[model samples]
Target: MKPSTHLVLLLANAASGMAVHDDCKLRFLELKAKRTHRFIVFKIEEKQKQVVVEKVGEPAQSYEDFTACLPDNECRYAVYDFDFVTAENCQKSRIFFIAWSPDTARVRSKMIYASTKERFKRELDGIQVELQATDPTEMGLDVIKSRAN
Candidate 1:
């Protein structure tokens, strides 16, 4: 093994590690116009298997009249929640959808922010989307788009 070869291998490995670490962030991507915001949720855990839409200005009570949605591997759901775009949480990370996987420790599931509700609905036909909130007083989204079953 040559010294130069070892050095190249080491650098490559380091770069790969960095890419994996930032997989959840999608640092190389940007939100498109009218798409709002987006992020990557590594995996959807069993306990929190649900996708909910928190109405604008609505409270986040389990018994609240909010909509509760679910997703299976064969089904796609449109998420339209505005509670996660705060200056605090949004700055730290971006997580929009959970990656449905069997591995409990799975990480990095890419979720895109498609442009426009009409386009989203049109493209994702046969899929029920979490309609965007129509009012204020709502800031929480219980997006349980995954299930254990």
Candidate 2:
């Protein structure tokens, strides 16, 4: 019998040699359990071969501020605590995992990010939505709103 898809993915991730730093999980727990952060940005440390926390948004930071933290020519992984109101006017919050691979980023960086995204995201336990953006416009407020709804 062929190996299961999950096993294949696990083997692929192991071969990639990119691991998520422990703090990546700790910070995500802070955000998910205590609302300590509005967003968390992550980057792959090429030298260390690990995905590590690059920056974090304060609880009061706006989505625009979160967007501003992302570099125009780099790839990053981010988790945002998004708040929205439903048609019934009830308040709700959702965690979003975003893969930001800008079109202008280096090809190698993009490939590494793409290959490692699922592995990194799996470490964060409470993500409610997932988005892959190749440009800022693709992840704009309107797009987020639509996804949240």
Candidate 3:
């Protein structure tokens, strides 16, 4: 599939929402964090055809669980620093996560519920992550491996 196709799935999850399987909630959260951001730029390596995610923001919670759930073949890494910039009374914070696969991406097909924070702080204060399926082939590494067997 084309790179744009993968991007379309990411955008759709950001705009609407993703429906992730019960077993893949953690992976879905990781992808949601990567896809939806507080404005960031990506540098894709043409020769390797890999996407590197970068952002300028403050440190928030990490998605280690999400990363650990990824397929063994997929490379997952994230870095965060303090760079909060806000003018309103509501304090602004941000986090960045990325889910990159060598040949495909993960796609979800149900309305899954997720939150960054365990408890609801406020209506707008709660943190969330979601996963949406781009295509049938976008299942996480584990799913692919299981199906292959």
Top TM-score: which candidate number? 2
List, in order, the clash count of every candidate structure. Answer: 15, 0, 9
In angstroms, the error of model 3 at 2 is 16
lDDT of 3 by residue, 1-149 (tens): 79977766665454232222232333323433553322222222223333333332222433333333344433232321112334554543433223233334222211111121111112112232222223324444344333322
lDDT of each: 0.27, 0.91, 0.31
Ranking by lDDT: 2, 3, 1
Off by over 4 Å in 2: 1-15
Which whole-number lDDT from 0 to 100 does residue 110 have in model 2? 81
Using TM-score as the yardstick, the better of models 2 and 3 is: 2
Best by lDDT: 2
- Rate residue 84 of model 1 by lDDT: 32
Over 1-149, each residue of candidate 2 has an lDDT whose tens digit, in order, gives: 36676655654565378988999999999999999999999999988989999999999999999999999999999999999999999999989999999999986688778888877888899899999999999999999999997
Could you tell me every candidate's TM-score relative to the true structure? 0.18, 0.90, 0.19
Off by over 4 Å in 1: 1-68, 84-149
24-139: candidate 1 lDDT, tens digit per residue: 22221222222333321222222333222212212233312322332223122222222333444452222232222222221222121111123323322222233332222122
